[model samples]
Target: MLRIGRTPRQKPGGLKARTGIFGRLKKDRSGATALEFAILAMPFFVILFASVETFVAFTGEQVINAATDNIARQIRTGQITFNQGKSTDKTRTEFRAAVCQEIAVMISCSASEAETPSKLFIDVRTVSSYDNLPPTLPRTGGAGSDINTAGFDFAPGGPGTINMIRIYYRWTVITDLVRPYVTNLRPAGSSMPNDYLMVATSTFQTENY
Candidate 1:
């Protein structure tokens, strides 16, 4: 007669070893902090970079605004005249130089202010009324369109005339994570958005000087 004795119960050493190893792994907290920190680091750094970039963008906007007001004041008071036949006559290039002199600390400008291919775009003209001022941004079509500078001109009015100064600067975005939301400007036909268009406009009547 064969006695079925539970097959002599095989030793569970290997099973116990595996179970013990798994238990030890579960109890180990050596790498827990590191793992959690690794998981949180991505968002932490993203927020840091985004915050820094936003502050920088705000500073840039203020810089351009100040420059616009200063330049507009000069044009309004006859301190800066365009294409006038006089010893103090200033050209568009000179006007750009004047603007660059104020904003060069924040934005880049060529060594020669008269140089073309600048990131700064300026539109100064005489307007009959505020309603006649440009109602739209200097964009061609969509948000991804290239800046339309074809209609831009430098024709500041004389004394007692109404003049408008509109300045646009293509601010290079540093943080890639916050670029697209910062501005709607992007190069035409390019999938990647890059720049933050900074705009400043001043409309006022030139003082009778």
Candidate 2:
């Protein structure tokens, strides 16, 4: 018995099985692409939405500024030809209508509901004289960037007066998901975290009518 050679060894099946398992793992590509996509999906969508939001914001900005400039033209041309104070009430109503009328249709500038006044916060006032005009238009403060609708003064001035029209808008993000990538200009305690401020100003002297 002792003279028998080394015991017959079992076939290396276990080793071969491990090698096959590792081989299959390397060749299996089903989940590889999915795994990569899962890792990059968040950033990809964030960029996509952010880019779209930027374009929309720029468009809205142009709308507000252009609308204010256009409205200013009316006052400058004497279309708003009215005396101050006594005629202020009527002028305000008409001017407000005009602002909404020429508002950017794409933006939600109208708020018939009491809860939302108008998305457009406006102030039209005339300084005592052109010499008194400040380098920057006067504005009341609120939650930092927010303009309280109550503080809006609608005084388009009388003919031959210097008047300024100021507009403010709180453009909100369609989704909060992309907010981190964009700057949040709204002050602290803002009603919405996704809100950004937009302001436009137009100043011109009302011509003698």
Candidate 3:
């Protein structure tokens, strides 16, 4: 009779205690959505930036193609007429500058801007033959190479002739976050590895002019 009121029997496995703890956690869903949003934000931004970079790269390629085609037409239609009286070297230099300027405008590049000129590599070649042709590579001259000699042949006429005008442009994403995502964004077989190059080659017959 003097025994204290018998303590309530303890739950056999503490299931009630565990259930209470878990039930409280389940009820507190206030921060769950916030945690999920934080987890997803990074990848979403990455994907968005990647998409923008990809679009810029494609737009650049199309612009280069258009400029190349225009220049090639000029070369093929004899608009860039070869004159025996004028120095071919001088004429070719002017032609390259003109074409490069055209491409600059197409891709929103500034020809006068020293910081990004090298970013737009414009190589125009007038190859006499494509046989046993070495891969087109960037020249390392102090003044840089001419557009007409940058790539393969864009000859007016010759045996097994292929008149080609190649335009190579490099675009560097100001943002490094998206650079790795783009494909073949740089020049073909280019040694400069960090930048994306866009190349456009237009080949036609001189006879067609």
Candidate 4:
């Protein structure tokens, strides 16, 4: 007796053969849901993080404004007096202390608080008259100052001298989306690195005391 070998033939649509119309219909559709979620999740997170960043920056600016306005009254009413001579270490410390009192409580006001004092820059100037007052916003001069240009003297002039206080906080943007949109004043090679700038200013004449 002669035995013949024969191969097993697959039917037109086998259970494992995913090639025909029936196979295509039976294919898994669960992955479609995951793909849809992945497509939408990215934009959702971007928008969410961007909004959080905006809120943080805006609130910080408002805090700085409030703190500056609150401190200006002290200078306006002559509570904080200026020495007739140059700006001494004691005067600088006292001014910083006053600023820190209101600002440090809310956010890191001084670089000293965070190991970098330039992070918060204060400029205070008292001139004999408003005619001597420099442009308020978009200051062309350098960072934190509490003095006048005349020999770089502390011009918190006594009795009825016009005074101006300017505060700047280099606020870093949280999200990358905001960094480009927000203001970035610091140059690329600067010691102090920041993305956005928060500025607060107040001007008043000192009371005769």
User: After superposing candidate 4, which stretches have Cα over 4 Å from the reference?
Assistant: 1-28, 84-90, 109-116, 136-154, 189-193
Worst 10 residues of 1 by lDDT: 110-119
List per-prediction Cα lDDT, in the order shown. Answer: 0.83, 0.71, 0.60, 0.68
Which pairs of residues clash in candidate 1, taking residues 3 or more apart in a chain or in different chains? none
- Which residue pairs clash in candidate 2? none
Summarize candidate 4's per-residue lDDT along 111-194 as a digit string, tens digits: 464333556667777767778776644533454322222332233556687888887777777676545555455454434434
TM-scores for candidates 1 onward, in order: 0.86, 0.78, 0.65, 0.69
Better by TM-score, candidate 4 or 3: 4
Tens digit per residue, CA lDDT, model 3, 30-102: 9999999999998888889888887887888887888888876766655654542433322444665666667
Error of 1 at 33 (Å): 1.8
Instruction: Count clashing residue pairs per candidate.
Output: 0, 0, 12, 4
Candidate rank order under lDDT: 1, 2, 4, 3
Give, for candidate 4, the lowest lDDT window spanning 10 residues: 145-154
Candidate 1 lDDT score relative to the true structure: 0.83
Task: Return the TM-score for candidate 2, rounded to 2 decimals.
Answer: 0.78
Q: What is the C-alpha RMSD of each candidate to the true structure, in Å?
A: 4.4, 4.9, 7.0, 8.0
